[model samples]
Target: MIRVAILISGSGSNMLRLVEDMTGDHPARPVLVASNEPAAGGLAKAAALGIATLAVDHRDFPRDRPGFEAALLRPLLDTRPDIICLAGFMRILTPGFVDRFAGRMLNIHPSLLPKYPGLDTHARAIAAGDTEAGATVHLVTSELDSGPILGQARVPVLKDDTPQSLAARVLTQEHRLYPAVLRRFSAGDKTPVMLGSEGLVRGS
Candidate 1:
């Protein structure tokens, strides 16, 4: 079984979706969930689901990113996860830390990518008068959100849509797309899965 370690922040909605989808007959198993905040709601949610959870509070270390990651790596390394999934993980990981996992790390971003690579994605899309907005699952390259795309699912920017309304819709697609992509990913298939108007299309 492929061992997956999920990193989360805040409510961990995506993390929960990943855990739920990876059960019984799935190609992977969620072995651990780690957070940068001790009070991250996901920690308790993950623990309640019987998965191991750990937190290395970044705030405690002030500006010491390396130190925080080092402490976070303790429980992480012990799990021997085959892959690390960043599900709403808020911390900006250092290159050294991200490099250690390299291609083994995956992240779900809130945009179609090669477009909006940072925060305020939905609002920006609306301001630009985009007809469609979406989410992407990609490799965790050193550059933030600049990773090779693995899969993407688009959602229409409905008429008179606010950022909040648009975000809610895109998030739903993220929950579905992330899991489907993961199932293929764990099976050693990195072919891009595009969920668009044409339905699910596979690419080389």
Candidate 2:
């Protein structure tokens, strides 16, 4: 079984889903949930489920990127996680920290990715008049949301959809895509791929 660690900054709805999925007959289980904020709701949710939780306040550390990352790495390394899953984790990780985990780290983005890589994906998609929008599960890399994609689930963008409505649709896809991507990664399969101007192509 793959021992997983989840990092969160907010409500952790995705973390809750992952825990529920794994506690069943799944091949991976979240052994730890760490949050940069002590007040993160995910910590409380993890406690309710009896999962180990840790809080490492990033703000307490110096502004030096490497120094801050070193403090963040302690609990994660101690957990000895097979994979680190970022679920609503708001901080930007440095390259050195990302390299330590490399392909073993994963993140669920609200956008289809390579399209709306950063924030406000729903609003951007609507403003750009995109016909399709969705979620992406990808490996974490030095570049923001530029890593190889593991899986994606696309949702149609209706003409009258607002940002909130569009986000709701993409969020539903995230719930499904993230667990499926974890299963694939745990099985030692190559992460899925998507080509520019083309759609998804299965990786060998």
Candidate 3:
């Protein structure tokens, strides 16, 4: 069985979906859910679903980046997760911390990655006059959102689409793509699966 540990910083809708997907006829299971914020609503949701939860408040650490990342490592090490899923986790992890997990970590980004790799992706896409925008599930590397892409779901950007409207559409795609990618990862495959202009493509 693939044991998973999830990290979240806000409402855990994506975490909930991952838990549900893993529990259904699959060997993957979420053993722990950790949050950097004590007030994160995902902690409660994880509790309700009978998943073990931990709150490692990032603010309690010293202001130095290394000290803060060291604090974050404790729960993750304790859980001994086979895979770590970053579900709306807000903090930018240190490179050392990211390397510790390496391919074992995954993150779902808001925009079809390699495009808008940072914050305000939806608004930025609209401003740039992009005709298509979506979400990506990728392996976590030391670089920010530059990891090997695992899966993606694209939505055409309509001329009438506002940032908020486009975001709503992309978020729905995220909820679907993230869980699918998790299942694929748990199955011991590292290949990339993507939806491109030519339909679904799997890359070595």
> Number of the top candidate by TM-score?
1
lDDT of 1 by residue, 36-115 (tens): 88899999999999999988888988989999999998779999999999999999999999999999899999889988
What is candidate 2's lDDT per residue for 125-179, written digit by digit as tens?
9999999888888999999999998888788889999999998877876776777
Instruction: Give the TM-score of each candidate.
Output: 0.95, 0.91, 0.92
Question: In model 3, where do residues sit more than 4 Å from their true spots?
Answer: 195-204
Give per-residue CA lDDT, model 3, range 1-204, as digits (tens): 889999999999889888889976776999999998999999999998889998888888767778877776876688789899999999899888898888889999999889999899989999999989988998889889999888888888889998899998888777777887888789987666665433344352
Checking candidate 1 for backbone clashes, the offending pairs are none
Better candidate by TM-score, 1 or 3: 1
C-alpha lDDT of residue 45 in model 1: 95
Candidate 2: worst-modelled 10 consecutive residues by lDDT: 193-202
Residue runs of model 2 more than 4 Å from their true location after superposition: 191-204
Candidate rank order under TM-score:
1, 3, 2
Q: Which predicted model would earn the best lDDT?
A: 1
Give per-model CA RMSD. 1.6, 3.5, 2.4
- C-alpha positional error of residue 90 in candidate 1 after TM-score superposition, expressed in Å: 0.5
> Which should have the higher lDDT, number 1 or number 3?
1
